[model samples]
Target: MGILEVSNVNKRFGGLQALGNVNLDVAKGTVHAIIGPNGAGKSTLLNVLVGKLVPDTGTVLFNGTSVLGLKPFEINQLGISRVFQTPEIFSDLSVFENMLIPCFAKRDGSFRMHALESIASEKDIIEKAEHMLAEVNMADKRHMTASSLSRGDKRRLEMAMCLVQEPKLLLLDEPTAGMARADTNNTIDLLNQIHDSREITMVIIEHDMHVVFSLAKRITVLAQGTPLVEDTPDNIKGHPKVKEAYLGEAAA
Candidate 1:
């Protein structure tokens, strides 16, 4: 069994079926990409995996335990961390302060921002945050306010926050979105470095084929809220179903 499993999952919104019988198995310690064109239910499926939206049917299992109906923080405590498409950070806070937040995270859906007063005593947490920041090459910017950083740096800071938590499964939602070609490539390289240095499993929902082929060991193509095919990146590149999903029936 994979580290993360989705079995017969379905979700709907009024007249629209956002996800239909979606079943996915993301193997342990592998980068799995979920790709499709707009309105293909990629975002909806991501929401389901992170417990933001409980599906109408089926189950989501993480590390052999059911994650359905759990709160987002609860899921995080269970070794799943998500990096959002738009970098989510405390814009007014220093980069170091933002990194410290997750280090002092409470499992009950709260952050201990007040703990900053006694931070001098929290040497272990401080070291961990510093190490993670350095891993993402943000240690030099640790004192800068998060809002002043460039888009790519902001994304890097956000990634460091998630990594500080040391999650088993990292869910990246369009990790390279809104980046320049150079920034996108740099982000890909950073991700590869992280993957190589850890035993983490990544599930990516991306619109960029370049990003997908660069990092994903397995790729799943979703069309109209259902999976069309799941295969290796090399095979997925020219798969007829993938072409049909993006280019329509004529190309297929």
Candidate 2:
């Protein structure tokens, strides 16, 4: 069995079926890409995995444990961390301060109502946060305000914030969305670095084929709320159905 297993999952919103019998198995320590056209339920599938939305039917198992009804924080505590399409950072806080929040939450539990407590006094937390920044190559910018960083830097900061908790599974939704070509390539390199240095499994939802092919060892193509194909990057590049359904003739 893979580290993450989704079996015959289904999700519905009112009369709309957002996902139907969607199943995926992500191996440990590999990059898995989920690609689809707009409204093909890619984001919805991510939501189901992260506990933002519960599937109407079927099961989600992480490391052989069920994770269907858990709260978002509960999911995080279970060693699953997610970075949204938009950068979710504390804009007003310094980069170091932003990192400290997740470090504190992971250690002290999710609802520590002690915002007034001085995080600096927690040497272990500070050290862990610094290590996380170093992992993302953002240690030098830790003192800068999070809002002042460039788009790529902000993405790096958010990624570091998630990594501080040492999650077993990292879910990234459109991580390189809206980035310039240079920034997109930088993000891809950062992802490669993370994959190389950690044993974490990553499931990425992206529209950019270049980004998807760069890091994904396995790619799952979704269409009309169902999985159409799952194959290696090389196989997917030449698959006839993938070309007709999603990749298009030009990409074939």
Candidate 3:
């Protein structure tokens, strides 16, 4: 059994079927990529996994436990973390401060609004945050305002925030979207570092074939809200159906 399993899942919206009997198994500590053309329900599937959307049928299991009805925070507590396509850091806060937020949340179980209590006083939290920043190679920019950082740095900071929680599974939605070539390569390297250092399982949704082939041990192709194919990178590249549905005939 994989660390994360989606078994016969289905979702619908009014007259449209968003996901139809989709099944996926993500092995532990492996980078699994999900790719498809637009309107393929890739984002919808991610929403379901992160607890933003409830499926109409089937179950989502993480590490052999059911995660169907759990809230987002509850799911996080179960060791599943999600990073959105856009960086969701505090623009007004420094990179260090942003990392501290997740550390605090993981420790305290929720956000504390007491402005008088110095966040610096939380020594353990500070250390954890700094360690995560170092893991993502953002330690040098820890004191910089999140808004002042470049786009790639913002994404790195967000990743640091998630990593501080020590999640078992990391869900990434178009992690390299809108990045320049250098930034995309940097993101890939960071992900590689994370995979090597942690036992975290990953499910990545990406449009770039290069990034998918480089990072993923296995790839699943979704088409019209259903799984079209799931195979190794080499098999996916040669798949005629994948070429017909996603990669153009000329490219194949």
Candidate 4:
């Protein structure tokens, strides 16, 4: 069994079937990409995995334990961290302060934001945040207010926040959604560096094929709420079903 498993999962919203019999297995230490046309239930599936939306049926398991009914922080404490499509940060806080939030997230869904007095006294937490900022190339911007940073830097800070938690599995949702080409490519390189630095598993839901093929070891193509193909990047490159459902002739 893979480190993360989705078995016979289904979800619906009134008239629409958001996900249908979706089953996916993400092996440990591999980058798994979930790609598809719009409305293919990619985001919905991600929500399910993180416990934001419980499935109508089926189960999600992380490291052999069922993930159902767990709160977001509960899932995080279980070693599953998520980086959203948009940068989610404290606009008023400095980059360093923003990085400190995850460190304060207790497994019980309780949070203790360190005050200015405690912030200085918390030597271990500060050092850990500094190390993570340096790893994401944001060490120099540590004192800058998070709202003032560029889009790319904000994304970097968000990533660093997730990293400080030291999750075993990372879920990325359209990580490069609004990035320019240069920023997008830089994010890809950051992802590569992170993947190489540890045994973390990443499940990416991306619309950009370039990003998917760049980091994915295994790719699953979803079409109209169901999985249409799952294979290596090279094999997925020329698959006729993928061409018709998502990619064009260029991919085939």
Give me the displacement of residue 211 in model 2, in angstroms. 0.8
lDDT of 4 by residue, 1-252 (tens): 899999899998999999999989999999999999999999999999998999999999999999999998788889999999988889899998898878767321465543555567778877888888888888899899999999999888888888888899999999999899999999999999899988689999999999999999999999888998899999999789998887555665
| Candidate 2 local lDDT, 41-65, one digit each (tens) | 9999999998989998999999999
Poorest 10 consecutive residues of model 4 by lDDT? 106-115
TM-score of 2: 0.93
Clashing pairs in 1: none
Candidate 1: tens digits of C-alpha lDDT, residues 1-252: 999999999999999999999999999999999999999999999999898999999999998999998999889988899999999999999999999888878322455446346778878878888988887888899999999999999999988898888889999999999889999999999899889998689999999899999999999999999999999999998988889889988999
Task: Please report how far candidate 2 places residue 4 from its true position, in Å.
Answer: 0.8
TM-score, per-candidate, Cα-based: 0.95, 0.93, 0.93, 0.94
Best by TM-score: 1
Could you tell me which 10 consecutive residues in candidate 3 have the lowest summed lDDT? Answer: 243-252
lDDT of each: 0.91, 0.91, 0.90, 0.90
In order of lDDT, best first, we have: 1, 2, 3, 4
RMSD of 4: 2.3
Tens digits of per-residue lDDT for model 3, 126-186:
8888888887788899889999999988888888888888889999999999999999998
Off by over 4 Å in 4: 106-109, 112-117, 247-252
